[model samples]
Target chain A: MVHQYKLNGYHIVLDTCSGSVHAVDEVAYDIIGLYEEKTEEEITAQILEKYRGREDVTREEIRLCLADVAKLKQQGKLFTPDTYAPLANEFKERSGNVVKALCLHVAHTCNLNCAYCFASQGKYHGERALMSFETGKRALDFLIEHSGSRTNLEVDFFGGEPLMNWEVVKQLVLYARSVEKEHRKNFRFTLTTNGMLIDDDVIDFANREMSNVVLSLDGRKEVHDRLRVDYAGNGSFDRIVPKFQKLVAARGGKNYYMRGTFTHQNPDFTRDIDEMLRLGFTELSMEPVVCAPADPAALTQEDLTVVLKEYELLAQKMLDAKREGKEFTFYHYMIDLTKGPCIYKRISGCGSGTEYMAVTPWGDLYPCHQFVGEEKYKLGDIWNGISNHGAQEEFCACNAYTRKECEDCWAKLYCSGGCAANAYHAAGSVSGIYAAGCELFKKRMECAVMLQVADALPRQE
Target chain B: MKRIQTLETKNLCESAKKGGCGECQTSCQSACKTSCGIANQKCEKKDER
Candidate 1:
């Protein structure tokens, strides 16, 4: 089960038993290459020959190594904020600490109304009329002020289709540039758009000034139009895909990420993922939509089981392509890879309530993206800076990994702190949200891996 | 030498399957599969830790 290969003269040894991937020596593979001839059969023969009848490597060792290779080769690691801090630091040095603030819904207005959209369903309740230039200024001020320790700052424009106020976005970027000069901070930018309005101008601006451009494209035409569309009940997939194509072509397929959300309604998820891969995006992220407050949508046991099934199948396809040296990366899957192992020992988990913060266009701030305005999870306000109340203290105090109850939990470390939003929403308190969610996500992961391995195993049929 | 040094020094290479779900009957492996197996294993260990 353990595999060893040399790439660019590096000896990459995948030791499954040790559950470790060791580049034994950059030269070990070269030595193997020089000493042993290359060929699939020869390589396999050589490996068996070298290890076979070796009394030192015990059967237990062999078993451990096979498992190690299988586990490491298949799964990466879950990211925690602490682990991502160094990257944040590096990005700060290269770009800045406050690189990007993704304002998901800048304007409450939307042309198409999906059944689940907050703005469409909630009628933009208490939400600002639009991401006014003033509101954008306040948010920029907070970032620039806080970004003193950073070299460059990136501001990402987002929305319930930000194109609604594309003019405001354009103006804000210009305004932000001036603020950067006034405050003497380096500024970079990007935007997440629904390709409906990716005209030549937006494409031109995105390609020239933006470091990354992310577009939301739900898979296949029918599924996409059904969930993401104008209020008139028409499909936007055909309209958006053509624009998305031109945008990708304009950039020559570099410096961009495609994000999609899947719902239970779409059964052919593999097809959806395939179409996206075919679209030439090296980076992609697919999150199952946080369904409505319905019987099946509420992370029900059955719902989770089905989602877990689909996730494993998709992940296996991704893994196979990756093994064959594909350049594409699924963002969530890459999270584990980018995190590496040992992420559990350190405070390396999600960036919630720490490095990253989300600011609504109206100047309200939430610690992370997942729980934008769930009042209880609100960490601070942009107008007054981060809330000075015990919110920070409350957040720090609820470190579930340190708790005894969670100590024995199988997913404590990697689960880090589960979604603060979910904690409040599910348990009505953040008290053990991390532990609870950790356990939940663990079950999902286990199911995913189990299904995939079973499918790969020799079948009875 | 550097590769060996790095590998030897890193505990991430430790293959100790301490407190894993494979030992637990109700774990996800009982019912289904996951996208990231190693991650799930690590998470199981982390939770156990």
Candidate 2:
């Protein structure tokens, strides 16, 4: 299918099935739009009517445009057959049972009460608690038993603050390592923390054992402090920055990412990113805050233009950095076009409900980390296998191909129908699209395209 | 128009679903490697290219 849009005065046509993007002239754009609906004679007549008075616009010119469309059709760039349906069926039949990754909510409560905390201050809107050692052990055992032939498995020690339940985490890692030889499975451990309790011992242990660490420090001191504050309303920036720096230094800035969140307050978000760079972070991802629209700091419709412009500015800065050989990777900017998501992913999304699952502190299983606290999404406990196969099947069924809006979207493949949690939060359905998030994704895609093209161009001396 | 006019028009997913697992294996592989220390070597090699 062909999806066309006008961006920055250029006519962009996207072939959805084949993932081919083209910048065509007005005549060619019109021809592409009319190709399926109208016969060649009708299309030619319509083109003539569009450029009625212009002597330069002739029947021959319209035919040439038609020829171009036909060429695209012949090259399988237009009207390409659906390859995802068969693959989706095959995947469901052969690959749905193997659970490869699990996000272990080691701590149910967090110390900081960030303004837009999705987990409602890390308690997941539930009571404050930490996962016991026995519960964690059972969850690991569940993963190992159900993992099928998958030799590699993932476990993330997540929480209000995983460091709050540091002992259990340490013991679990040691336990997982001990059982790996017997089960013929290798466990890779990751720790996500707020960095408040990251002392020398915590840092030393993480550096030695954790395969990756995600440090949450929104941005600059002021921005971070405004939203992410302690229980006493004190800013975490002062306490966390030093710890984060030490952690990064110890890890040699590898296998870790400094994750930040941008809100309506930070319209010129590039400045926050610049601050991160100045603070000596190389791997960075500054995501837009996702929360209820009622929140004062949440990004609204009014903020879309400024937010998109900020992304453009950041993209330009990234290109400039690349030129200077001081390049740092931005998570959103790193879209590998050639080896991007497959047709299956573009349809069914990241396989959250099937391939990946999240386990709460009490061993309650859910589709993913985002759905951990909500009781309705609970698949089962670790003691029992997945009891709610229906819910998992429902999530697995949600793909771009099944969503009416996404069927015609050019950005569908890149977006993969968007995050399921964001969709549920926005419109109460997994197939729905959040408007602000969708807009941000499109802007990012446009910026990514520009960056990719910029990189391919021959550098002038 | 002037900014993007010089962009070499290209398909975003040229080799997508050609021979490998039809997913952006980077995310899953990285999630495993960073969080678990278990690397999907097959995906790691593909991502490096």
Candidate 3:
């Protein structure tokens, strides 16, 4: 049986075979009653009226309009006039040339042995290393030269462990301050760390220099211990939480984030939300673990349930936090609020080829954290820089998935194609890492958002 | 002929004789054989209504 699914303005056919379905879109649908049951003559009259006094409305113009309308109608897809027109205007308004975010991999060496390490793929090995002072200068120079005068640039420090290379980080932060001073450019600094390194020195530096810091904590001790362990198989949770405590004490509910990755292994992980709040972290970001056969942290089906359950719980926890007079915010909510209408145009999440770019120690520029090691999807080498202009062009052209197939997908906007590393290693592609994660993250966020939004509303007695 | 879920699930341990249907001999088969065992489970739960 053939079932037609209308997405955006296009029609796709899903062919069902033996209870399985495959999707295809080829035929154009007719558009007479697309907006209702208007006759062809009535539609023609309306088009003529709208295009009145325009000498360019020739027979060809009318024919094209009819064809497009017909195609839309047959596909059972129709966009209201008000909705479609502004979206078109928005497409024209977006700046096609700006890089909104920049990911700087300041170090190649990691402090822990994550079982699902993309760095260990094929023959890629880990080594203790840091981005040199010279490379740091070059990166800053490149950003200064390339960024437009009016653009806001965010510089994010990623790792092995970003704090492992604190020396270079200090230099970079100082440089970014100078850049902001000289160019009067809007500059924001953020760091993603493994939490064990969030001591006083790091907290002081982040508070003084960087705008925000993200710490990786996979729920509780056991789940984190199993996946993110040191060489001797010791768990990092107990060691890392204290450092987070210090940061909380230092910042004291100002604005610091605790980021957690709950792979399928952490069952009923939602319980950690209260614990995280109790620990005094005001902001939180949670990501579900994507499993590959070779990933060290593969969990049972029950684990995945726990991860989702925890996300749902976090939503309720945020509501409870508000009720208790606790002031806190999640980044996802900020995005939905601040990002204006063309949110669909923003890359679903983050990556090099989209809003951000990551540089490895070898001076190779891949999209972002996810595709750290796979060489095939390497966008550019740091020494020479991104060479393929067209690949970047195609990367920009992809719209955030929002058709019937992708709408209601939780990660729709957040997944940002999944990790570039995951795409490159698992599927040997870099095109949709953000999309894969977008679907998952969207599912996570929607439940959280609904719970919070409901909690925020005035109750009807 | 008997149904074999996905080839990857039944490839390792499930033995089928030339003229006979066979039972899966390993735990992995139970998970990998169908439209992905995890996916199947989700679908089953979804369909309960």
**Winning candidate number (DockQ):** 2
Writing each residue's lDDT as its tens digit, candidate 1 over A1-461 gives 13354332334443322233445432333323433245434444555556677554444543443444334334431110122323222322332223133343466556656655534432344553567878887787777776544445556565556777787788878887777776766665667777777899998877876666777787777777877877677878888887877887889655676777666666446667788877665566565555344723234455556655666566667656756787565544432322234432222223334434666667677655445556766777777766744664444444434345444444443444455545554565654453333544654444333333333333222
* Native contacts present in candidate 1, fraction: 0.08
User: Which docking class does model 2 fall in?
Assistant: incorrect
Model 2 lDDT per residue over A1-461, tens place: 66676544456666767766666667777778888999999998888998899875798877766776777688777766555645544654566587778888999888899988878898988899999999999999998988887777888888778999999999999999999999998787889899999998888889888888888977778999998998899999989999999989988545887888888888677888998999998788777777788988788776778888888888888978988998987766775545444454555455577777888888888887778766778888899888987788777775555567776566666666667777788889876767667778777777766566456544422
DockQ of candidate 1 compared with the true complex = 0.06
True contacts kept of each: 0.08, 0.08, 0.00
lDDT of 3 by residue, A1-461 (tens): 22334332233321111111111122122222232557656666665676677675544555665665445334333331112213322442254444445567787777788776545521135455678877876776666655654345677787678888888889887877776767767676777778767767888888776666777776666667887888787888889988877876777445556776655566566655556766776677555554565465654555655555565566666666777899566544432211121222222222246445666765666655555564555677656767866665544443333233334332333332334344444454544343344434544535533533344334312
CA lDDT scores, all candidates in order: 0.50, 0.73, 0.50
The CAPRI quality class of candidate 3 comes to incorrect
Interface RMSD of each: 13.9, 7.3, 22.7
Q: What's the TM-score of chain B for every model shown?
A: 0.18, 0.19, 0.14
| TM-score pick, better of 1 and 3 | 3
